[model samples]
Target: MAKRQVQTTKIDGKRVRIVTTTGANGTRVQVTEAEPKEWELQAAQVRALRGMPEYGKQFLLAGDQNSAKRGPRAQMEASAAGMTPGEADMRIYIAGGQLRMIENKVGRGRLSPAQVDRHAALARMGFTVDVLRAVTTEDAAHQAVALVRGWLAENDNQSGQGQPRCSSTACA
Candidate 1:
């Protein structure tokens, strides 16, 4: 006969354990660090972005913080992707079963045809994309949150219609 394995759900977001076997003395355990999978990271960044205080929010999409040459935005992106500082950046977020992205483009006049096609592809995979042009750190965070606020408001309005409310707090 084959032995069975025991699986355990983790309380923390970052770790999990699977018990492959047990002996007379002790149980064998395998621990896996739950680094945010790409999708989870994307979703968290989006939710963390909601209702952010106005001051630090700008760093979300552009690097304008401090006196550094690239600004907070450039710093954050470089750190997030493990890329060299000063390179351009983008981030995606998913919440309430919706997806959004923040793209820091230096210049723009509406999305290019290729960009639209790419956005459509993301949509097919269940994401709603938003792009923000971040010339600086202030640009990055502020624009990112602003986009989310608007999208969330729209989502709320759509959901509220014809829905029963438990209390006025639900409306708020």
Candidate 2:
């Protein structure tokens, strides 16, 4: 028997670990399971935010295969199909007038380099971007609502209009 060897590598910029062992049968290789990525967790939070009657219909999931699980081949195909990098996770409409983008993050999760670049591009195009992070889903939701309300108010003020009102069906 020979001592086991361990090493780390990166796939798609995410860290992965590999181990190799030698025996009478030659060498065997094993890869450790990667930790759950933040996208799914953040997606669940997005769903929760959308489920709320107050703001549910105002948001739509954006970006590539938001809730779908994909393998390497699928990812390659998506890229080949012209998927844009760093798209915001959610698109939100406020007061039926303003369009905004929301990027959701979970524990210690930060935007990737591509995301940072995309955000800048979108901002240059005069888009509103918001990042939400909180200790709890409820807190995030409240913060999002407050941000939207403030945006609506500011837009109204700039347009020389009074405060915008919310309707039963939409945030008008």
Candidate 3:
């Protein structure tokens, strides 16, 4: 039997757990990469989102506040009073002060009521909230990268440029 609680390293978008058992044959080690918990999956998505281009862009954390950071009484009120949830996952700022929201969700995940409200509010403010879906965090990360590129191109095209001019050899 292996301990299901210990997480070792993360691969792709999921954290891996390693276990070791000792028997008459000395020592045996096993690695278990099983079902991912919601937080773990969400964390994987965050990591992927951070991999987007580093040029003229900044990443900022969003969503729920850490419970540990709140006082005991504060936690009680926050849960009871129904604190309004912030934007999901992350907020990225591009060169021209454009802000966008990015969230990664698995098929089984659902947004809470507060989250839904927050998203609606953000949309009304002219911010595009992109929720990416994929089978794995790794796949979602690739989508994030593509999205960043698209946003850059969109801004460029809207700035009186006919079309995006790619300086890379691939475009040439």
Candidate 4:
């Protein structure tokens, strides 16, 4: 039997790396997943964000499809500990902005209020934050997007922009 090859795929945002090793039969036998904590949320957000029409194709085509990487602080520490920047967290590329820090996590992890506050701090620092839930239904994703859009919109207005309000009951 011929030996199979190992393949690496970007996790949809190049935040981390996914490696798949093939068996002798040429089928994938194992998969490895790794992501930096800070970029995890951003990656998840981008993943969820990609489901929307506005950002889907662009996000997919941006060539940044990988698992999340360590935060700037962590990466710097890692460097001091003797590692390359590539070994650091995958940077988040927001529109018209330099790559920024991001936060990502997978599964149904309940976020505490304090945690959310910390996340906000990261946001203030221009880092995108993402929280991945087990969210089993498409409706859940839709509801989440609606909620976030409304939140951002409202905040935008509060800070002085006539952003259109969402009138959907699902969002109200």
Candidate 5:
């Protein structure tokens, strides 16, 4: 059996409400799964990228689908419906001359249906699209840095999945 509970606690000095799940064995499957706002997650990711200028720069607003939602005439009606949903958050330029797109999600966030379809289309077009999930907003920067660090350490151009390990932990 599984049990679920909603609770509020402090994370990195900020109070957050989280939902947790426990498995049949009474072991916690998820701990403090704080659902940070999309903007908050994006900002944290940008901070991570900016701090590691050698690896990545801040996310470009022009390329960020999430950011564009705040601009004037954000929704394009049917005019932008051909490509499925919005694009990934970051178009990371690998030093090895490869490109990988990253979609950031915090906690248990997921991509929308249209985004999933778009991801499939991009894959068919030989584009490497991956979602980078962080366990918590407090550690989102660390997780993002780990991802870029892995990308930087990798010199192989053969495959995007064979990412090099910058340290013991790899981003999920």
Candidate 6:
């Protein structure tokens, strides 16, 4: 029989559990969190930024609702409805007629395997994808806002001629 061991550690000021079990073959470890505190904080910050009048354009939520607690039936329904795993948290339409995807992470959080695959796929399709991490800090948040503001400024300049420059092939 294998004995299970659990230990607590602080992640971004939140308590997380790391479990380990030793079996005849080897030892296995797992990490879990009581709640995604960091992610939630980052999401709130992102929403605040999105709500700003300067950046209040059309931004769509790409993540699934109640995804973590979804049952098999719900999963099936989502799949049928064309919901994909690892979709970016938000999709924004830039002024220059470009579509951008944003994925938010906080602290030392890294992208899941599915996210990595999806990012690669999107990149291959010529879409711009950006991962915004560590946004819980004011400095990081400000930097992100500045980056988006810069993009908006450039986009505004490009479309200053009354007719917006379309980046899509069908624009002609």
Name the best candidate (by TM-score). 6
For candidate 2, write residues 1-172 as lDDT tens digits. 6879988788777667788999888999988744334555455556665666545443343434443467989878887987667877767655445677877675467878888998999999999668876645556667766665676567667766633346665444
Model 2 residue runs over 4 Å out of place are: 1-69, 80-82, 95-97, 159-172
User: Tell me, what's the RMSD of every candidate?
Assistant: 19.8, 8.8, 9.8, 12.9, 10.4, 7.2
lDDT tens digits, residue span 62-167, model 5: 1365434433344564336532355787777664346777787766777887678777889999996768776666577676667767766564444555443344
Candidate 1 local lDDT, 1-172, one digit each (tens): 3354866566665446465766665666776643332223333434456446532222233221121356678868756865433221344332334434554453343555656666677778886555555433444556666666676566567666423334447334
Q: Where does candidate 3 stray beyond 4 Å? A: 1-54, 57-86, 160-172
Displacement of residue 94 (Cα, Å) in model 6 is 1.9
TM-score of model 5 (CA atoms): 0.58
The 0-to-1 C-alpha lDDT of every candidate, in the order given, reads 0.48, 0.65, 0.62, 0.44, 0.63, 0.65
lDDT of 6 at 4: 93
What local lDDT score does residue 165 receive in model 2, on the 0 to 100 scale? 48
Tell me the tens digit of each residue's lDDT in model 4 across 1-172: 5455555566665533434455566655555554334333444555565666634211221323222267888767766975532221233333222233322234544555655665577678766554434323343345445544554455455655533334566324
Give the deviation of candidate 3 from the true structure as CA RMSD.
9.8
Better TM-score candidate (1, 5) = 5
lDDT of 6: 0.65
Instruction: Estimate the TM-score for candidate 3.
Output: 0.55
Candidate 6, after superposition: displacement of residue 128 in Å? 2.1
Q: What are the clash counts of all predictions, listed in order?
A: 16, 0, 0, 27, 0, 0
Worst lDDT 10-window in candidate 5: 55-64
Residue pairs with colliding backbones in model 5 are none
**Segments in model 1 whose C-alpha atoms lie over 4 Å from true places:** 1-95, 107-117, 123-127, 161-172
Q: Clashes in model 3: which pairs? A: none
